[model samples]
Target chain A: MNPRLVFKAALVCLLLVLLAEGVLTLAKRHAPFFRLFQNQIVSCEILDDLAACSLKSGRPLIVVMGDSVVYGSDLHAHGVPHWREQALAAGLQRQLPQATVLDLSLDGALPGDYLGLYAAARRLKPDWIIFEYNYRMFSQKFGSPSEAVSRPWLRGLMSQPLFPALPQTAGDKIKSVLRKVSQLYRYAEAFRDAFFFPSREEVINRLLAQVLPSRSLRDPGDREMLLKLKIKPHYYTPLLTPEHAGLQAVQLLENELRRDQQPHLAFFTPQNQEYITEIADPHTWPRNLAILDSILGSLADQKRFFYWNWGALYPADAFYDHCHLVPRYNETFAKMLAGIIADGGRRDHVQRLE
Target chain B: MFNGWNENIRAFLLGLAFFLLLILILIFGQDLSSSKFIYVDF
Candidate 1:
C-alpha cells in the first residue's frame, strides 16, 4: 500500500514485460517454421496455415470453412487421428491434385465466426469457397459474430454490413487491438501446442484410462457410443424468432457473397442420420431443418450461389462421434466434393437429398 | 529521495515474478481468460 513501493513495482513490471516481448519476437523470426495445430487455430489465424503452406501455381484455390466436421474430430477412433494428410483438405488435394485447398476450420466454429474468417481469407484470392453449414450454429448458447472473439479477426473492416453487435466492453476492443500488435500475445498458444508436448492432454487421459475404471474412462466403444451418445442440447434448436442470430449471420454472409460475386457452395454439413434418428430429438431436429430450408429458400439472389443439403449422406458407422467422421470417410467425402467441383459446382450437380 | 532500489533484490524478484506471470498468461492462459464465453470442448 506504500506509494513508493507501488510505483517502483509498476515500473519494474512494465520494463520486464517489454523485454520479454522483444525476446519472443526474436525467437519467432529465427524459428524454422511456426506450426499452429488445428485446435490452436482460434478465429482468423487460419491464415497461419496458409502463410506456412507451400503455394503452388495458384490455379484453383478452394477455401473450406466449417467446424470439427472438417477438422476430423473423432478420426482417432480407428487409430487414425486428425492428421492433415488424412483430413479433408488433404483428401481434396489428392482428388483435385493441382488445386490448393485451405481447410480453415476450428472445433467449435459457429456461423457468426465465418464473416471474419472469410474477410481474412479474401487476401488469399480463393477461386471457390466451400462452407459447411452446421445446424448447431443456430443454438442460442453461442453469441453472434461481432459480439464474439471474431471482432479482432475482422480487424479494421467494422463498417461492413452484418456486424451490428458491438464488442462486450471497451477493454475487449483494447485487448483485441493489443493482440494485433503483438505476435507473442496472439500466437503463444500456437507455440505451445505445436512445438512442445502437443499431446499433454492426450498423455494424461491415456494414463487415467489405464488406472481408472472403464465407466470413468472417457472411451466408450463405437457401437456402445452409437447406442448411448446423445446429441448435445445445442444441436438444431435455434429459436425461430425475428432476430434469429444464426440464420441472420448466414443471410449476411450470403449478402456479402452476392455483392462480391464470390463463387460459393454452402452445404448442410453431413450428419449421422442413424445417430440423430436414434438419439437426438426427432421432432425438433426436422422441424428446425425445415425452418432452415425455408429461410435459405427465400434468401435473395441465387446467382453465383449454390446451397446443397448433404445432411444424410453418411450412415451410423461413418461417424466417430456426433457429426465427426472416421478418417477414411474423410477421403470418401473428398471424392464427392471433387465431383461437385469437377462438374463446375453446377446447379444440376447439387441435389437436395432429404 | 529516489532510493527505491535500496530494496535491491526484493525489487528484482518482484519484477521477475511479474514477467513470468505475464508470459505464462500470454501463452497458455490467453485463451482461457479471453474466450471463456466461446465454448470449445475440443
Candidate 2:
C-alpha cells in the first residue's frame, strides 16, 4: 500500500474504534459500568476546576486555603447560613460594615495551590486571607492526602487511551475533549439512574450512611496528637524538614503583603469545639500554642497575627463533622477576621527604626 | 516532511472533530451548571 493509503487506513481504523466505543457507551448507558461513569461525572462536575470557578464573581475576596475539611464539604451540604461568600461578606460588613467578601477555596488543595493564591492576592488584593488546614491533609508526597481523593477521577480520565494521543498543550484540552463524549453518556445514564438508580435525595441518604459516626472519634482533648512538641491535635512535622512547603508558602504570602502593602493576619481555625476547650486548658493548650507563639515571636513582635481562640466561645453542635465548623461558626470566624482588618490590624505593634 | 505534515494534519482534523462535538453538547445538552456543587463552593 502507498504511504498515504496506509495513513488513511490507520485513521479510519482509529475513528471506527472510537465510534464503536462511543456507541457501546451510549447503548449501555443503563448498565452498571455506564452508570458508574455517570456518577463519576456528577462528582467531577462538582469538583472540577474549583480554583477558577469559585472566583468567577468579582466580589471582595476572602480566600480559604487548606484541605478537604476547610473546603466546607459539610457546609456545602447544609446551606450556608448567610450563604458562603455572602456570609463572609455579611460578617465583614457586620464588623467593618463597609467591606465585601469573596471566597476562593478549593477542597484538597495543597501548598502548591497557595503559590497561585499568593499571586491572586497580589492581583485582587482582598481585605483578608484566611488560611485553614487540617491534620490529615499534610503528607510527604504531593503535600496532602486530598490528592489521593482527587486523583481517581483525574487518573481515570488521564488513563483513557485518547489522553496520551492528543497534542500536549498548556491546558487540559484532552480531558475537555473526552468530557464532551463522557457528558453525552453522563446525561443518558443520569436519566436512567434517575429512573432506576436513585433520586438525588436517596443518593445523599446512601452517602450519609457511610459517614462514620462523629462520636466514633474521641473528644478534642483525647484525640491522638500527631506532633509531640506541638500542643495542637495533629501536626505534620514541617514539610520543610527534608523540605519545607509551609515556609515557602509563608514567604510568598509575606512577599505579597509587602508588595501590596496590605495588612494580613494569621489565626488558627479551631476545627472542633473540643479543640477549643483543649487549647483553653492551661495545663496543655498554652503549650500547644507554643508553635504559634514561636511564629508570632519571629515576626518582628508585631500583633498583626491575631490569634483568636474561639474554641471556648462555640459549643460542640457548632461543628457538623470532626473538623468542619457549622455555618454559624463560619460566620463568627468571618466576623472576627473582619474586626481585625477594620482595626488596621496589629502590625502597628511592630517597632520601626528611624 | 510530507509524511510528518500529513500526520499533523490528520491529528488536528481528528482533534477538531472532537472539539466541535463538545461545542454541540455545550450548546444543546443538559445543564452542567455545576452551581449544584454550591455545597463546597470554591
Model number with the top DockQ: 1
Query: Top model by TM-score, which number?
Result: 1
Give RMSD to native, each candidate.
5.2, 13.7
**For residues A94-162, could you state the per-residue lDDT of candidate 2 as single tens digits?**
555444443444444444345445453444556566665333333333333222222122333321222
| A215-328: candidate 1 lDDT, tens digit per residue | 433555633553253245666354555366667778777777777778887878788786666555666788878777777766633455677777887777777755777776
> Could you tell me every candidate's TM-score relative to the true structure?
0.77, 0.46
Evaluate model 1 with DockQ and give the value: 0.30
Instruction: Assess candidate 1 and give its lDDT.
Output: 0.63
Worst 10 residues of 2 chain A by lDDT: A154-163
Off by over 4 Å in 2: A1-71, A78-90, A93-97, A136-244, A273-289, A300-313, A346-354, B1-17, B20-42
What TM-score would you give candidate 1 relative to the actual structure?
0.77
For model 1, what is the alpha-carbon lDDT of residue A82?
45
